[model samples]
Target chain A: MNIKEYIDTANKKALERMASVQPILIDIELEAKNIIPGMDNKTILHAGPPIEWERMCGPTQGAIAGILVYEGLAADLTEGYEIAASGEIKFDCNHDHDTVGPMTGITSPHQPVFVLEDELTGKKAYCTLNEGRGRVLRFGGWNKEVLDRLNWMKSVLAPTLKKAIKHSDGINIKTIIAESLHMGDEGHNRNRSGSYLFLSELTPHMLDTTNNEIAKEVFLFIKKNADIFHLNLSMPHSKLIADAARDIDYCSLVVAMARNGTDIGIQVSSLGREWFTSPASIVEGLYFPGYSEKDACPDLGDSTISEVIGIGGFAMAASPAIVSFVGGSAREATLRTRRMYEISAGTSSIFTIPSLDFKGTPVGIDIRKVVELDETPLINTGIAHKEAGIGQIGAGLTAAPYDMFKDALKAFGAKYL
Target chain B: MKSNMNDLLSEGPKVINIGLRSFYEASETQGIKVVHIDWKPPAQGDIETIKLLDRLL
Candidate 1:
């Protein structure tokens, strides 16, 4: 296969297909196994590349143990840990099943997930709902309280949102994301404005779908948590968009970039489902009071899916307020987005930055350009405590290690050159 | 014969700094005009990797 014969047009098609897809929040599913292809009762899907239970990081192990207990496979987290260690639980990558998760990115078959779809291509992707900050499962928090929150989400929140979404004939996430860019949400780590926009779409329908008390309770559950309620929705929205561009012959743009706590992985458009990985990098940023760098885990999560299609960190110029949360100056945040264009193959005509004279956000991370340029994707993310149950300690900045891109380029060469 | 450096330095040393950012920062602190290029050793300064990259790029 001569890459020169096909690469340029192939990449252009990949970029076009990626940017053109409109991910709409079409449904809320009760079970991950029902919507996610290949997920099973005993299988626990995780973020980033596949790994055995022995090599799994602390946060991931904690999250998995909690989910096992939630699935009723174990009596408690302590027992859940032993079952997880015994290898009785099968593990799979979330990307393989068309799903993404945040932080430790644990997805049990019974957990609630948002299903986003592109009407034109009928492509769909799924992501589990976000449990609001502090002692949440995504950060490896598991106990009676944590299980109670998960249970409440399943019993009340999921059904309410499903009814509201169906009542509204599906919320247009593409529209909310476009508008939110102007209001300062990169659609990843900073989603305060997007949450309000998401609520604007859902609130009226939420009122119509449920009784007054339930509506108010669910409404405040989202309304009070301004930063994260929209994030789970954003992840699946980006996943749906990125899935459309995967497996295009000779296209070298990255389709997914996620960290499994132990390793950070990237899947290229031309490389099919094979992942190029590097040891997960330590995040650099401010820690919460009483906590320091020592408490933070390595970069972990499936949230980078938003960056894969260009909103998250790639659209940093549109969300300067993120500097305070992600720990950087406003200028640095803007520069990060400008720098991304150097490695990206294209820009999204829809997700434009107001600060940059309405210029489109850089999209399409090309693996060849990444190797040549030696610059990697800049990510803004939450930092989890290395110990399970400690939850999030801070939020910060990280980069995909360059070696992964080099390895991917060599693989591309071996196959195409 | 005239050198570009001579003319450049004659006007109080405007600088085009590459790789190391401290040099550009020092120049800027002195009110000198400076541009910093964020340069790095491509392919990690490995000749074999560069050779491979050359084939594909």
Candidate 2:
């Protein structure tokens, strides 16, 4: 085919891929089946950028070990050491299940997750509950406190969320996200507005079912960390939409997000179920007080994938405060978001950008754009310590490596006519 | 006249405020008319003046 034919074919393939793709809900219960609940040495944890054990960051590794001890998967440090060597227990990447874990992102059988389903195409995605604690599972740590907390989430928080969501007749997260962006949230790195919106929508239901005292605590929990609570929704929401654009043989769209506690992996639209991975780059940005890059984990988690589907960093212009968190000027945020247009195939009908005079937010990542411009998508993500249990140490900006897509594209070209 | 000058700059028109003396003299000597009207908002920033000299036509 000539260049014109190629261009037309590529664009059409991308659009068709996006339209046919569906986000499926992979219930956490289903995922948990793979894990033998309670810690055992058999379970091993890994992290971002494909680093060796010696090079592994501290906090993430700590979290991984902590979960093992907590789960009783191993007796103690000595036995856990033996278990690690015995390799009797299973160690796996969250991405293998169409899930992305934050920091340590350790999800075991005992944990319950909100499986976000794509009603259109019957595909599903999974993510663990928002560990009310800052440095919980996603960051890789399990201790008595963490275990107790996870128990509460499974027994109390998850059920309450279910009841509340059911009471509200299903939360239209996309709507809340769009509204929040206008109210100063880019929908990822920062979620103050979205958090409030979520609470407001869920309050009536929460109030109707529970007593004022119980309701108050749950309300406070959501309100206090309204910023991060919405993260759970954003991840599944992005997964839902990205899944919507999946499985068109020749269509090019993004399908998966994985951080092996080492490198980040992404699947492409036309690539057809194959992962295109790149070294997880270190995040660059301002951190919370007393925290520095040294305390931060390399880029880990599936949350950044939300930006890949648009509304994370791509809508940064709408939330200027993120400049402080993700390390860039307000103008740079605007430019960064606008730059995404160079790599995307379309804009989301549900999400809009306020800074660009309210243009539709870019969505549906196109491999052709990546190949043609050599520009990969930019994701704003949180930093966790390499050791497990230390929790979140910071937040920053990281770009998807182009090499992954370039390789995927090569594979795609060779496969198709 | 001074008040009118300020009003012209403030409400009447957006012109460079040549001092009252020069403006008054220019109007007086050049047959230009100066009118004092109700104080309105200043003219917008779009007005410009053009000059053409008749050479050997």
TM-score between model 2 and native: 0.76
How well does model 2 score by local distance difference test?
A: 0.64
Q: How would you encode candidate 2's per-residue C-alpha lDDT over A168-225 as one tens digit per residue?
A: 5566667787799889898887888888987888889878877788788788888877
Name the top DockQ candidate.
Answer: 1
Tens digits of lDDT, candidate 1, B1-57:
378768876878767999988898999999998999999888768787788867666
Stretch of 10 with least lDDT, candidate 1 chain A: A1-10
Predicted complexes: DockQ each: 0.55, 0.01
Query: What are the runs in model 1 whose C-alpha is more than 4 Å off?
Result: B1-13, B26-33
Candidate 2 Cα deviation (angstroms), residue A32 = 4.0
TM-score of chain B of 1: 0.65
TM-scores of the candidates in the order shown:
0.95, 0.76
- What is the CAPRI rating of model 1's predicted complex? medium
In candidate 2 the C-alpha lDDT for residue A30 amounts to: 25
